[model samples]
Target: MTDVQPIVRLAARGDGVTADGRFAALAAIGDMVDFARDPPQVVPGPEHAPPPCRHFPVCGGCQLQHLTDTAYAEFAADRLRRVLPGLDPVIMAVALSPPRSRRRASLKALKRGNKLILGFHTEGTHKVVDVQQCEVIDARLFALLAPLRGLLSGVLADGQGAGVALTLTDTGIDLLLANVTADRLDRIEALLNFADAHDLARLSIEGPAGTETMVERRPPQLTMGGIAVTLPPAPFLQATPEGEAALVAAVLAGCEGAARVADLFCGLGTFALPLSRQAQVLAVDAAGPALAALNSAARMAGRRIDVQHRDLFRRPLTPAELAVLDAVVFDPPRAGAEAQARALAASVVPVVVAVSCNPNTFGRDAKILIEGGYRIEALWPVAQFRWSSHVELIARFVRPG
Candidate 1:
């Protein structure tokens, strides 16, 4: 008889593990794994769920689709606990974004003979899955897939490939095509006609030269706080609107009663604009276009936000410079804000809100703050990537008054 082991928990890469140090792909918690076979076989458990999308386990877009919502939330929270084992902070419940809420996605397109394969790449491979339907992206974005296929068929030569970046803004879909040429007059006219026909807010193409706006029926805009800011070509945005709201709420809660605040790495002022309503805000980022958009929006709305273009990674604000701020909110990229967190740790800032998409990096920064006499008051695990293994979080670290 083959010895069976019960799967205990999910690993960082969405693989199920057992107490005896066995791993099974697509296995859920409470599932039984039989190890007698060359490769272990997973028996469906109570926590197992039927993936809503038919492309599950094939498309690299999502990983934990086999997990029930409850189990998925638990997985997200468990990931956080694993990363920050020694830090006993109050971890709030996981905030999971609903299906079809993703506002942006990048897809691949390849023309093979008369057929055009367009979709996300398969896991661990560059082969495109040719998605017929997707449950992750917004319905509006998915609706453009068919139209894009038809358009690309005429533009792409056999064996040629291109990249498609789709973003849903307040006005409409903002589309950017990469590695595709539109030098010919007919191709340029087709692009313009396609933009007009589809009612695209903006359409741009990136070729050997650079990005050129083919058409801008309307400025692709996003309303942050109450200010409408023109979105630069493919600006960094939160995966889903719900996730952004949750992060913003957590940050605002942490920085409550703050008189002066600095929003570090504030891309297009998602949190800075809202934080400015009650406090004086200094928004800083490395991207000039994002800062320019934020500055324009702030000026037009009569909101006071001092926008500065500076790379935090290269030159993080020093402890002396941070002394004047009542609160500091920094949402760095996946690399996390190591240098900025160190500066905040050594500073006298009363409230510090650290927003991160990677738990491992956040854990390292949290320890640095703790070593600097700051206590983590609260931590919120946000599953913005939904069924994927990625997990985002917002933590509050404060120095005792």
Candidate 2:
């Protein structure tokens, strides 16, 4: 009908919003909606594209797959813009990773009678999608799902499920199965055979006692900044390589001429190892194993990266300690580095690059820094979790006189 209202934008949770403040599910920007019915009907628009994945709508992995590239980017950038309304920082183009680029994901594998369901949980529900196909993960990763289902079905009894984490490493896929038991000897043998046949780099299972390594065909390593670091089991890493690069580039650009830099909350030296090329870097994190791996990689490469195993949340570097560094870069987890940001605000550090996956926490931390006399110079959003509400951003801040 001529009275249809067009969806103007996508809300924070991936629902399309109309100018009249109505929300429609699975609708995209520019799509027309007929509000005459009790439930509005969405008519496809030029900005709406067919979702390539057969598992769309059913699979909870992605939400904005129906939106065009331009529309998707806008939704991500709008998140940051809305958070910092007062500032006009340079907003960089969204770095959207292509479909099937997700390097790591945790999947649920449940065995029911003769059938084994393996994939993401259903949208807002516990039901498994039993993914026949996926578009959000690497082709190599999706290919392994079928084999994983087959292998898991052999050991997982009916009514039982295992939390499976698969990560693509330098050598091969590293798998970690939680809530797994080897009470039956045959299951243990089957697991070993599966690892060998699939040439998995490492396979670890968790049971009542503790986590046990079933196979370590080769050390699962991730090479970053020319250093080969053997990652700890299921370590936190960038969801996509493209997103990591974008964050690294933003951090580097912000710390261009600094002589000494401190990488706070540095997990596995993602930025520390790379920033060390131009400046001496002090890498700090609470995870001892991660720091150990980073230190080992630096030593093997003959690079002197100062690694510290300390909890920043409990004992963030003080202003006196932070004053020594020319610049600082912090990539905190989703909860963000609130106390650390406060300390940085009080410090004499000239440059800071903040990377975060959670925009809300980022906004909170950014405000703390801004109040502490730091000016946001650049903002870049990396949509690695494509088509999802999840957004990652890198913000550059500089201390002004």
Best by lDDT: 1
lDDT of 1: 0.93
Instruction: Name the runs in model 1 displaced over 4 angstroms.
Output: none
RMSD (Cα, Å) of model 1: 0.9
Per-residue alpha-carbon lDDT of model 2 for 167-244, expressed as tens digits?
999899999999888778898898899899989999999878877888899999988888888988888899998888
Give the Cα lDDT of each candidate: 0.93, 0.90
Task: List candidate 2 segments past 4 Å from native.
Answer: 1-3
| CA error at residue 223 for candidate 2, angstroms | 0.9
Candidate 1, residue 131: Cα displacement in angstroms equals 0.5
Clashing pairs in 2: none
